[model samples]
Target: MVSSSSVKIVSKCFVKPKTIPEESKQPYYLSPWDYAMISVQYIQKGLLFQKPLGSIDNLLEKLRESLAITLVHFYPLAGRLSSPEPQKPNSYSVFVDCNNSPGACFIHATTDLCVADIVGAKYVPLVVHSFFDHHKAVNHDGHTTSLLSVQVTELVDGIFIGLSMNHVMGDGTSFWKFFTAWSEIFQAQDSNKTNDLCLKNPPVLNRYIPQGYGPLFSLPFSHQDEFIRPFESPILKERMFCFSSETIKLLKAKTNQICGTTSISSFQSLTAVIWRCVTRARRLPYEQETSCRLAADNRARMYPPLHPEYFGNSISALRTAAKAGELLENDLGWAALKLHQAVAEHTSEKVIQMIDQWLKSPFIYHIDRLFEPLSVMMGSSPRFDKYGCEFGMGKALTLRSGYAHKFDGKVSGYPGREGKGSVDLEVCLVPEYMEALESDQEFMSLVSL
Candidate 1:
């Protein structure tokens, strides 16, 4: 047996867990976004101090004891979707290491550590940094999706841990809940209160079941075919661009005036402009039905607050459409109205009914067909900036969404609260499309401002 005295002490943090009601158990398939969060975890290590150092193994033992319940919770599903079950608590595996690098002494650097790498020996998973490197090469044609894989290299000293999860499992909120619970367990152990870490009850398996289903919505078979097909040089290309808050406001005001509509939302106006500009740049046939799908948070819509501690997937998509020429030719107000109606229709009871119908269908055949042929996916989540990620080390210098290449292009929007009420947006498009947009003086003026 591993001795508690053998592990060393390190920094402590918290990870909360996601809890679902017992009744909703079977119909839930992990969302791709939820799987993305499975890979992130905390790193713990020791820094230089005047007092004597403790055992690293002992610290890990305490951590293990505190996290036993959570680990058990995740263990059963480890390989359910990916591989076979791991020999140990693969969900809670920890690593230790020692470091004596150049920034050692005056820097108050760490030497002993425990990381959260959970990938088993057989699966050669990529790291987050490496994933970013790969993202730089391919332009988003709006048809691709990307996953972030994080490996915690050091909990202390030379030891490192890796956590690999798919995006469909959960979003940032769900992930943080799990993270906080993990930290709380470590803290309880540090203070010799291991008993407090025990869970009151095991998680109840709550599966979702859609009522009366008859092929509810149109599935994207054509899109799936294209997804599996080798990447033919896309006829279109995507680019990344930014726009200032002031410019967006000015554009919105102009659009409101042109369409003579007082109820236009910022999202509708901005998206209308983007669609118009992009289509104008590419000079594509204007008769096609250009579509855009937005990711919507279902937290408020769900019955209970989906237990903030529940660390699994919890989001849905709302699709919007606009005729290419109509959007390009109409005034901003008219375009915004059209866009708003489309988005609103997507969130109605009928839409939810359709989603329910889709989920209740046979899993293997239904899910594969549902997500095919999505043209563009767009979303906005400002929680990253609002979350307390400070950890006593000043705010993060940068925060970015992980890459996605599954659609023709992806547009992620963020609240530009840092500077006025302008929205900060990130648009991922194929290189050729991006270039064409950039070269246009009118579009450049809007984005550059």
Candidate 2:
């Protein structure tokens, strides 16, 4: 077993597209939502793959070749985030400089660690950082010149593909789009016999949200057009708890019995249980108001209805609230009902209202609001089929977010590997709170260690 103390970097280099796609030559506009994200690097996602069907060198070569080909279709990733002309004093339009830029940094590293060394550990995996490229601090422009970066780390028994993308560039939806494309290219061996690769479904780049939303400058939130908060040290501990198909079924059935209705989904049921447990574990006062923010993907809910391939931040923040007393005192159904209603309220018109609101004030409400007590934000999708990414290799052994998710109270859920109605919760909380959650009898009963 490789000692957990050190992971060695073998090589590091930039891989630009063989030729910049013509479409990428123009500057891609940043919508109000995109602009809200410029100051914070909110998302860094990663995946771990076991042995592929080739030698380590051959696999790395194919990965690099396929990545170059894939960058052609997703050209925006190959560019840098830039600020243009002085529309106002110290005020400028922040847009992606897609013209000429060095492509993403590709990192190759080796770790004596095994995949199981982290994922299989008893204490909880804090080793997610081993899979990422080096994070370079931003320059004076207050924007990261690097939009996308890749780090491929070789473990004793597997490979980890870490992708780090700026939130301003796009959201999780955009990240997954590029991920799926790279996966396809890798599987098909993007470099054919002669080595030519292109995306079959090129992203329909839509910078504007189909409304007269103002660009990033119009937002009233930040002064000098930026917020550069020092990176506070994070005190986070993550533990994965798997809820089997049987437990979920029981939760669903129990929730229906408590609510006298069966309309709530398994997701709603589990979210309610988690909220209640977290609220109680945090020891918030009975009267304290606690909220769970469910990220609503609005690709299909927009007015014109964005195509599934439409790229950009397409998230609608949906929230459900309850006092700690009411949350813990009542049967789980009440919380489920609140959560269900919160999600159900996001009709097409509601999405348009959110759009217009951003047009009015382009700032993202959730960026700096994390770490607040009594607030929990949901971060991924069990239904997004994250399990399907296979690049000439077996599927990922276990896919998880980077260490950036260590913010207090951020909760992530994905379908369990058992597949029949199972769910897994990757919960990050204070050490004591996590201990409380682990000791929670009702909650622990449903969790599989």
Off by over 4 Å in 2: 1-5, 134-144, 190-201, 212-225, 230-233, 364-366
Candidate 1 off by > 4 Å: 1-149, 152-164, 171-240, 248-263, 302-311, 363-375, 383-388, 401-403, 415-422
Query: CA lDDT of each candidate?
Result: 0.41, 0.73
Q: Which tens-of-lDDT digit does each residue in 243-304 have in candidate 2?
A: 99998998999998999998898988998999888888899888899889887788887767
TM-score of each: 0.54, 0.91
Candidate 2 local Cα displacement, residue 239, angstroms = 0.7
Over the stretch 302-389, how does candidate 1's per-residue lDDT look in tens digits? 5544453455455665666666787667766775666667656644464456445544431211222333232445655434343232
